[model samples]
Target: MVVTMLRLRKAVTNLTQPQFIEGYRKAQLIDVREPKDFEAGHILGARNIPYSQFRQRFKEIRPDKPVYLYDQNGGKSARAALFLRKKGYGQLFHLQGGFRLWTGKVKSK
Candidate 1:
């Protein structure tokens, strides 16, 4: 991602699966994995904003709403949260274990 904004060390909330499932309906659920990974299987209703495309597509996610993010593991989502926080996004949350550990329903193409 481009480094055009201030790099802030803002803390993003890490949610367990139960907590994530509880609030994701009211937030923007973003899957930060690559498209292929997203296409294979992802949380139901999640929007794809792959880490590779985050710099260009992040604006598509509303900064006003809470954002819930995840990747194959927690790493990419954590990075995406850092990037989004730098861009002035305040309400950030990520699945603690990410998609690989998600026990909820998923959508596969």
Candidate 2:
């Protein structure tokens, strides 16, 4: 497994919206946005574990599958990815361009 911090270019990441959506049912799709931002709108099926609480709640996240994170602008999600890496999360991915670039049919309730 990846045991060290690896910086990946957003373009090089092997994650796509369709792939993420399909994998959502089988993997963990986490929204690292604030509670208020999450309440506003977020990807369907995404669980809120705001960035602030992620470190403390790391144990709650599964390490066996990929974890996808997305924020309003992508910055927070990237931060989440970095945090996860430092926490030994090997399978982490950030939504390219974040939720703002999501044009899929999935909607937040």
Model 2: how far residue 86 lies from native, Å: 1.7
Per-residue lDDT tens digits for candidate 1, residues 1-109, read 4342233234588899999999999999999998899899999999999899999999999999999999988988888998888888999998988888999999999
Per-prediction TM-score, please?
Answer: 0.90, 0.78
The TM-score obtained by model 2 is 0.78
lDDT of 2 by residue, 31-105 (tens): 888888888888878889998897798778887787877887777777777777767778777677778878875
Top-scoring candidate (TM-score): 1
**Ten-residue segment with the worst summed lDDT in candidate 1?**
1-10
Number of backbone-clashing residue pairs for each candidate, in the order shown: 0, 0
lDDT of each: 0.89, 0.73
Q: Which candidate's lDDT is highest?
A: 1
